[model samples]
Target: MDYIGHIKLVNGQVPSESLLLDEANIAASRRVDLHVQTHDDPVLKLCLWDQAASEFWKKFRASGGTARVVLVTTLNPKRYGVLSLSSMTPSRVFLDGDIQETRDYLGWLSLNQDVANRLNADVVVKPEPATLGELFSYMKRASAKVAWFECTAAIDNVVHGSKWYYIGCGDCHPKATKGPTTLLCRKCGKSEVVGVAQYLAKLSVYDHNDQAFFVLLGDAGEELTGKKAAELVESYYEANDGVGDDDIVPVPQVLIDTIGQTRTFIVKISTHNLDGKTQTLTVTKVLPLEAPAPKVKSGDEVDVELCNEREDLADESVKRAADGVGSEDAKRARCG
Candidate 1:
């Protein structure tokens, strides 16, 4: 379906706001939230992600930012506290004369420019900074829906035993399960899929007196560790030449090195947290260490030094091949 509307705003172009979502390799993965006003939908926000986002901005710049009417194709309709349209990989953005609909809409917009002018473009939702306690509290509320928040927390522990990375369908990146012969992706409903390792690392994070689990999904791990999950997995396999397919790689030292560091994370919350299926926060982005961390609210500061239990839990499963902990014998031990 094509969404034709008057483009009210495109994020990252707003002045005095360094609102660049520093979540991904940015250049390759940019996000543009479109404040569009259309017939029947007054405050529709179209989220252009990855390719769609970068290209839209390119065309917007080429047009001297005068392109008012936008025509976006293949948007996935969603409601997350607000009605929103999110673009997928196949989505494309068109503006002004680029498409017949946009051209016609632009002509119509020129006649009723005041209608577009009446819309408040500043209604876009920006991620608010929240503490772990506050985030979980929101989960219990009946009104909680999909939302993003920035949380500054100290790395208390790197979770152990959980699979650090799962073999994902190479095309879509969904986790693939072991099939009769090859890995299968249920989401794609296919067999013999292309399998590639992707990050699914876990960390125990704490802010003030609130502690919560944060799962680094997709490229979030790579952004924090400064190394690709595939590279780390390949290095491990090369070192241990013939490890069994069933044998899982232990948490890499690169991730462990972040144990005591403090970083601000952009976490996304949804029904997964609200329904109590899991309270684990899915980390979408990590702010650079040099950037000032969000201030922990007064009377809620947690002293990690005094939390000896967290340190102990992190070191319990240190990647120790010398002790045969990560060896074939260790793998068998875990099953037993």
Candidate 2:
């Protein structure tokens, strides 16, 4: 179970980007990333858990950062949006001259230095933490179509009157609009679409640095509340039998229960944020609240001036979302 490849980038050199959390919100072990096939293969994210990640860095640093070629033993293959390798408990690392295998790999790298020297930040590095104020600065810059960041913030309140769920295309999950006798999925260009309920809640969240609104959409909402929007909507109709199926259900108790809790959010900035169309950072992933998470706790009164400018925009977006008539990015039938 050995993986040998050219080391493209090594993270954890700084304080902000050091930690990596899995979808379940648990801290993972160490990792060292690489690409194979003479560095022509797609980038592979090597995630090392526990001490594995730290240990790799320790070895890399000891090599004076001159070691580009690497070989590691015992990697557990994993898939999370992309292919990755997780170092197992017995996993170990080897630098350029650590052993015969690594020496041979170094020989290959020496001959293919041109390929080994190429760097793709997008492929090698994970997103770093950004503050609410910092995200605002990116509005003026032409950045990536979508960018992600880690933010620790407290949920101020669930935005009432905002549509808590969206009616999405049953197949592709894009928001579906009503047609004469069927649902219309413009994204999929399907005239006759089946509809399904999906989570799209809005929250007034704040960090010590700034306060902004977070759109809790899809699985992120499910992660926070431990309930699915579909099931919640279904249970509501079941209790209120006389009500129509299309009625808007208020934010459920499970969601509201999160109002006073502080948690870490993996925030996604879309074209809307980059182009100054909106300031709302969509929550794609939610992390559990713990000691090392957000500095501000739930229901804390943040600085009034920090939120003044962003408030109007957030309210307008919420209104548009409540009516199911916002920008097509309402795949914020996303907060993707």
Scored by lDDT, the top model is 1
Q: Rate the local accuracy (lDDT) of all candidates.
A: 0.69, 0.65
User: 129-149 in candidate 1: lDDT tens per residue?
Assistant: 788988888888886766778
lDDT of 1 at 248: 83
User: In candidate 2, which residue ranges exceed 4 Å CA deviation?
Assistant: 1-125, 142-145, 189-191, 289-336
lDDT of 2 by residue, 192-231 (tens): 9877877788787777878887787667888898788889
Work out the TM-score per prediction. Answer: 0.55, 0.52
**Highest-TM-score candidate:** 1
**Least accurate stretch of 10 residues (summed lDDT) in model 2?**
304-313
